[model samples]
Every structure is written in structure tokens, then in C-alpha cells.
Target: MSRDGSPPAATQGPASTGFIPGNKIFNRRDFVRERFGAAAWDAVLALLSQEDQAQVASVDPGAWYDVHLVERLISAACQQLKLDDGLLMEMGRFDADRELSTVYRWFLRLIRPSFAIRHMNLYWRRSHDTGTWRSWQNGPEVSAELRDWAVSNRAMCITLLGYLGRTLELFGGKLASLEHTECRSEGHATCIFRTHLELPADEPRPGRRPTRADISSLARELAHSPNREALVEALVTLLRFQFGCSWVEVWVTGQEDRMQLMGVSGERGPGDQRRFVLEVAGRAVGRLELELPRGPGQRGVDEVLAELMPWVSIALETARVDRSEPHHVEESELARRLRRAREIGQLTPRQLEVLELVARGKTNKEIAAVLGRSEGTVEVHVTNLLRKYGASNRAGLVAMFWGEL
Candidate 1:
């Protein structure tokens, strides 16, 4: 049974299907017509293959073929491979301590034999996986399986590579090289091929040591830092440092709305503008913007957007919850006096002042000045008194208290 629990007709055994130079048979126009309906094959070939390249060479850039055909081809390949055997999954065990060379050999015998690889060689990260650099030394040898797979499914591999390339591009990387070669040893000979995706170097590690003292100091700094601006700035820096973008902006809208931009080093030309929406509890509360050259950055931007989504979601939720909570400020004589005026004289003095000011249409800042206090201080006083008497903002406070008074 396949993944969908259906019986295996498409998943026929390798031996049952005699390997006729797979590529040759599949390459025939009749095979395409029979396997995929003529119309579907034509559509896919038109968009994905070189079939239309000659005529379309003179076509306008804006009239380029729909790239989604590549996407659909890849999606179909992935779906088929999943229902059968995926090349990447077949190449090696994820957690096993496998030699890169052995893995490469296995890829040749298994995965490479199933694709129409003209030339390929695997190049890996310098040292992280094995603490040693490995070099490519062999050439590609065409096999019966490869020819068959290629003929039947060359579109799949091309689509897969494009999808993989686009995917890596999202992660600050690109598909860089592909090679095919032939190898011979002790009267044994075979074809070798491989593909490589190159990721840009990671950001330089921070110089500061994360010691106990450093952690304590950072904690103190965070405690003192203005949360919203600090958070926004940090998010921008993170996007740039992690994804290698030049400009990032976050727009937050709530009871109080704000926009913050970071990584704008100097005068800059325009870049691709992508909006990553941040949702909290399924409702969007904010968005992030990346302004950078588009070309290959689409993949990386998509990745960055995915990575930043949860962080932004958490931040927005925190902001929403925090907005409802009261602030902790040093009690002042004015606040005490106002509290007393309400209790002793059965009067809401703070309420009276806020209402009178509102009736006169005074702003929060103007009312704060009239009452000899900071705007924030005025806000808290108004908020506390309104809550105590079950009212809303200054306007609502005025409506209830003024009606009673």
C-alpha cells in the first residue's frame, strides 16, 4: 500500500518494469501524449521545457511563461515520490553517521540513476558534518534506471531542482552547481552525478561572552528598556542578521499604533517589498516589511517571514495583554489627594477634573499640564479612577460621572 493506503499499481516493482533506456522511451512525444493527456503534456512542456524558448525568446519580459507550471510539476513529483520513493529521502539516513563519499556513492547508485543528470558532483559544507573537507573525484555514468526515470520523469527532476532552488533561496542560499561524470576502477565502471546548493556564510558569531555577569547585566538592561521599541528594533536586527536583508520594518497596530524600521544603514535604492503578516489567535495584528532586491531573495524572504511569524505573534499577544494591565508607578500626593477627595467627600475629584477638561475638549497632554503632571501619569490617573468607578476612556468617564454630578 502507498501512503494513501491504496494498492500499488503506480508503485510497480522495479524488476517488473523492464528498464528500456528510460529516457529514450519517455522522450518520445507519444509517451508524453499517452501518460499525460496531450493537452496537459503540451501545457507543462510549454511552461517548463525548452519547447517554447526559441519562439518566446523575443517575447516581452512581462509576458514570461507562468512560473507556477514549474511549481505544479514539482508538487506532482514530490507527491509521486512520497507515494513511491523520494530521491533525497533515499540518498541517506538522516541520523546515521554515514560517510559523505558513501552517501555520494549511494546517491549515484540509487537517486542519480533515477534522474536525467547530465553532469553532477556533490560539494558539502567545509567541516561541520565531519570536521573535514571532502572533494569530488568522479564523473557521471548513465544507467538504465536513470535513463528510464529521466525519460518518464525528466520534468519532475527539473521541477524538483527549481523547487529546491527556490526553497534554498528562501534560506539565503541558491542552487550553485551541477555535474555529471564517468568513473572506472579495477574493471568496474559507473556514472556519477551530483547537485549542490550553496548557502551564504552565517552571520559572524557575537563577540560578547555569555557569562553570568553578562546575563545579569542584560537582564537589568531588558528590565529598564522600553519594551515595544526595544522589541521592534531587535526584531529588525534579527531579520537582517539572520536573513541578510538590508532593510526591515514592523508595523504594529493596537490601542496604540506604531511603525519601526531598522537596518537602514544609509541612503539606499528601493528593494523588493514583501509583507509578512503576523497573526495572534488567528487575527492579524501587525505586519513586517522587507525592502530588498527581489531576484533570488524571494525564497529567503519567505523563510524569514516563516521564522519571524511566531515571534511577532507572541509580541503582539503580549502587547494586547499588557495594554489591559495597569502600570506600576510610585504613588504620588496628587493621586492620593484625588483618591481622598473621592472617598471622604463622596466625590470623584480626578473624575471631575478629567470630565471638565474633556467638556472643554482638552487633549490628554493638555489636561496633564493643567494638572501639573506627565502625560503618562495623567493617563494612569484617568485609567485608575475610571476603572474604580466602572467607566471607559476620558470620554466615557465624562458621560457617566458628568451625568451623576
Candidate 2:
């Protein structure tokens, strides 16, 4: 059965009866049709039986095309255009991998919902060493139509090989070889492909130790971040540049056993890829993940994370505190105390006016109307007052002013 609980289409016969519509196939068909023109598309269809041609003609953008239909169409298009299979395979690899990297971070999520987390974890644990990565997918389990194609037109497996190769290459490894180790058509339980990556040359590599200046500059940039989101984003960006990883992501635990993606740098990968815990006072706050190429240059990743954790902890704590309620006190008492503090000298003319309205218990909107200014302007003044007074909220600002009075 497919993900939507639809029965798998049979593999051995005409695809007209078994094909299902999918976004991937729909988009591919439209692109091919537009690129090759109606005459070419009709010619490809004419290569099939009259019934199959009618089915192709009837396919709508939203409707599902049989897997067989889709595959045959691709083969027909390539043949008609006199495109080399190897060239087409490489094109498929490049286009599919590019799309998967950029716009389809959750590509596996859509296809393997049940094993998504497990698959991700597996990808992360697997070493990206040259000649290290290998994986297999049971063709029969994917779709009966795929199994049928495997049994009959085995040459079409080049498309699958290209796709798998590109997927591995996305992990910052080069494909050295990909061989079909097992095939359902050959009486194996599942189709299996073993992959090998070209190993990096063994050589003495120079260590990229972070200089004192680099650390100081990074610290300064992070410290100047105005909010937690900005701080996390800056950290992710800095890590990506420092380590030269393909991607980085920050995931924090959320309510109800969920994980929230706080920030990401670069194209998101399928799995955790590489993960380190972010702890504050020995309590886990979040995780930092990355996908890096095989090389000697990434040896400093752990040291960089160690240096980063303290800053990240501080930022997370500050954000949490900022969201919580400020210490409560009577409003009149606070206002009275502010009057006595006589700290009005700290405020500019406009800020003083804004502060007075705030002390008078006016909302930002009300203050804006009374001052004949924008609500945004009033908000800025209020924020400035809180910052200048070292206050957490409007109430705290009032308390700081009145306490001094």
C-alpha cells in the first residue's frame, strides 16, 4: 500500500489501470511537456499503445499518473531526444539532489513517514568516509510497478542509481561506485545497492586553530545580538563558516515531546547528520547539528562548540527570563517612588514625555494618540526606557523610576 493507504499498482501490465497521481510526477510531466512541446509529447505517447496514449492524454495536472507511465514517458522522451542515458542520469542526479537540498528538506518525511526518524538517525550515525556509505531500498515494497520494471527493463535502474548516488553526494561525499548487490527480480528479498566513496588522500594537513582575535570577534558579534533568535542565527552562521559544513541546524525541545527547529544555516539535511548538545548549568537546552565533508579540517569542531555553548546558554536564559512576568508591585506605589527618585534627567525630551504617559498607566496606542505619534514610535521610546533603566517590562520600568524617586 502507498502512504495514502491506496493499494499498490500491479507491476506487470499496462500502467493505465494502476497509475496514481503525485506532485513529483505531475511537476515532471508538465516540465517535460513544456520543454519538448506538444508534438514531441504526442510522439512519445504514440510510442505506447492506443489505450496507453489515451490514458496519457487524459492525465491532468492534479491527477496521478501510473508509476509505469511516468517511467516510460521519461524513457521515451530521452530516446526521442537522442539523449545519452549516462547524461540523462547525471542530469537527474544534479536536478534531484539540488531540489532535495534546497526546497525539500523533508523529502523522506513524505515518502517514509513511519521510518522518518529512524532513517534520519541512521544517516547521522553513518560515517561519510570515502567508501563508507551504503544503503538499500526494497523495490517491491516501494511499489509493485517499480518491482515490475526491475524484473523487465532492468536497464531503467540507471535512474535509480543516479538518484541514490546524488543523495549520497549531498552528504559531502563523492560516489566512487554503486553496484546492485541484490535484486527482487533475481529472487532476492529486496533490492540492494552498495555504494563506495572515493577516499581523501592521506596527507599531513595543517590544523586551523582559532586565533585569539577570531574568538574575540565572534564573541563581540554574538554579544551584540539584540534578541535570542538573532543570537542563535548568528551562532549558526558563524559555525557554518568556521567549520565549512554543508548545513547546520539548532533544535530545541518543545512541549509534548516535540522538537522545534530554532534556526538553520545552509540547506537542511535529511537526518541529524551530526549533533551536539547545548547545555546550560548541565541541563540540556537544545542540539546543534551539522553536515560536513570528509577531511582533516573539521577536527576543531568540538573545540568551537565548547567555546560557543557558554554564549548560547546565556542567550537562551536571557530569552526565557524576558518572556516571564516581571516582579509584581502596586502601580501607584511605583509611580509615587518614581516621583521621589527624580531620575528624569536620564530621559530625552521625547522619552520623558513617553515615560510620563507610561507612568500614567497609558497603553502604547493611547500614548501614541495623546502624543500625536505612531504607535511604533511610542514602542521604541518604551523599549529605550526599559533598556536604559535595566528593566524587564513596563512595570519594572515604572518601579525603577519610582524607586529612585
Candidate with maximal TM-score: 2
What C-alpha lDDT does candidate 2 achieve relative to the native structure? 0.51
Top model number, lDDT: 2
User: Each model's C-alpha lDDT?
Assistant: 0.39, 0.51
Which pairs of residues clash in candidate 2, taking residues 3 or more apart in a chain or in different chains?
19-66, 20-64, 21-64, 131-197, 337-402, 338-401, 338-402, 340-405, 341-404, 341-405
Compute the lDDT of residue 216 as modeled in candidate 2.
49
| TM-score of candidate 1 to 2 decimals | 0.23
lDDT of 2 at 290: 79
Candidate 2 lDDT for residue 209: 36
Candidate 1: deviation at residue 59, Å?
68
Candidate 1 residues 1-405, lDDT tens each? Answer: 223423222221122222112222122233334544577545534443353334223333223233322223333334433323233222212111122233223222222121112112112211111111222322222221122121123333332233223322333345455433322211223323345645332122122212222333322322222244444544554444434455555665544334322112111236566677777677665677766555654665565456546656566456445545332212222323433435644544355455445544567787776555689976776676567667656677556544553
Tell me the spans in candidate 2 whose CA falls farther than 4 Å from its real position: 1-23, 26-40, 54-63, 74-88, 94-101, 105-152, 185-189, 198-405
Residue 247's lDDT in candidate 2: 71
List where candidate 1 sits over 4 angstroms from the true fold: 1-226, 256-270, 295-297, 319-405
For 64-136, candidate 2 gives per-residue lDDT tens digits of 5566665565556555654454644654564455446332332221222213211332332221111122333
